[model samples]
Target: MAKSQKLLTLCIAGVALMSTTSGPTTAFANDLPANLDQASKSANQLKWVRYTDPAEGAFSMDIPVGWQIQGGMFRFGYFDVRWMMDARSLDAKTIVRIFDVNVPPYTLPTRYTGRQGQPYSRPQQFQMMVSRYLDGQSYAELYAKHRFSDSCKIMKPRTSDWVPTLPASWKDDPGGRGTQGSVSFDCDTSDGPRVATVFVRTTVYPNGLWFAAPISILSTPDRVTLAHDMVQHMIDTWEKNARWEQYQNEMTKIGLDRIQAGFQQFMQQMQAYHRERSAAMNQQVARFESQQSNQAQQVSRWGETLTGLQDVSDPMTGTQFQVFSGPKANYYVNGNGVKVNSDVSPGAGFHQLTP
Candidate 1:
């Protein structure tokens, strides 16, 4: 297993530093009690009951009587399943199907049966069976098909195994493996005494056999008829129930809904980002145009100041010279014969042509 730790540094302006550690230390104390022995004992002594609502298209055994059922199925790749929590056990108890081991009810089209003792490879039979679950929708159809066979077999061996049950107070965790699948439970049935949930996992294979592992959650007492009921439910109800088809369909829909929601959110964010970028680009272009316009006006003013120049001939000596003047009497004259004057101006009143 590869584990990577990431550290993030946050800087808040003008905020007082309350503590240096960013870890969730306070939650650790409250989440688990101090006495391990008491906790263990309490977990074993708990009792839970079951409930069913056929109208809701869902049924769970040995769940806490009043716990709400978030009635739905979810799927990831080849696996499709449903789950419920026990209310009396603080929603601690749970039940889930890791795989369906029942073979398809269709006749074998070829002599090569894919069952372990078959003489030849039953590729056609294998493909047909896998096709039912895949329904021509998955990207990796063959892979999922193979997984169906592998996971089904692993789940077969441990189905009827019995173990101690958990108390009604402690919750069960079908510990997550991050990839495959897990289901945990704590329940009391009319026949089985009390049983802590065992984890069920499945692995699919391409050849034919579907392997599954159904391990008891180890310490749950065999109270009432839970163990027997659970086993029978697996072989009788789960495998034979027409409801599995609906469960599969629901799971497929849930997977698609998740994908669609993700895609929609991605597109929305991208559109917003693009709009912001376009606005920024337009602002930059506007600033550039304004600067160019100002530069053009400066050049136009320079051109106008230079346009006022004219060549003039002196009346007294016939000396020609270019002279330029502005509105404020600022002007330049170019000629050697122009008379030197102490001061020169006219209209604005100037004395000129004085030696």
Candidate 2:
């Protein structure tokens, strides 16, 4: 890319970062005449404007005018970021957030040895993700408890409906996808009782890590519907900036080359440093090896767990195996090393496995 183009891209990104974090959203949300709290009565009057991330300009979303908006793509560590934002009514009754920062990575402590097995604890981080399955509703309920107050009560609506939106492609992802879940809650806050409905979406990968995000709308019980509509509108209209993505990709490549060069130099220095620490480092390898073997045993199980699979045991041979969990077929095994799923018996000596 030309130097001028690079400079222009940075300038645009700079503008976005300022706008989102500085909360110029309240100023740009100018198209609507009615306030967000009042617009709840007649959603048709609501107007929206594009809110772009100043950090990378990677994404943009249409948000209702007049809402007090802040937050944007935040860096997590080297080469990773959680793109998100928070928007709310001037009255502070309605809020819409894209991602939860406090959620932990899907990886379990058991997956790692030594200090890596511990949960991430900085001096204090109020929110985080967990190893829980995310089919949407269950996660939504969990999210409610964490994002809201602990004592918050989930109210199961009589309708028996819990539909949330998800992409069919999520299932095809290497990390299996989860169905969206929605749940409403009556939460008690310092101000008073408020009703909140949260929707969660997630996808789990083979490494026991999952990408998940939540969309929530909260308000007084009387205003919940309005908040819901506003949140839904944003979800439906959210868009990504392809140009910004290209710029990021270009920058990433440039940065990666620089990092690789620096890393090579660092490694050379580290080799000498490690020789001095080798005597001490050797002692820890044995402990890690023991844990590594245990981790090996759980590899398939953990993969199944993250991918929504399960283990089955064949009574005839007293052998066990893992397969996708579903009611579609019976899993069987013969003298083979493992089992396979079939509609009927594969042959004699092939016993159906018990789930």
Model 1 lDDT per residue over 214-333, tens place: 323222342224433443332232211246446544544554556556779999999999999999999999999999999997886677567864444554555566555334433322
**TM-scores of all candidate predictions against the true structure:** 0.28, 0.57
What is the C-alpha local distance difference test score of candidate 1?
A: 0.32
Determine which window of 10 residues in candidate 1 has minimal summed lDDT: 5-14
Instruction: Give the top-scoring candidate (TM-score).
Output: 2
Whole-model Cα lDDT per candidate?
0.32, 0.58
RMSD, one per candidate, in order? 21.0, 27.6
Give a tens-digit lDDT track for model 2, residues 9-102. Answer: 2222321111112222234354455464554653456767877776667677787777767666554332234455677777776677766544
Model 1 misses residue 103 by how many Å?
27
Point to the candidate with the largest lDDT: 2
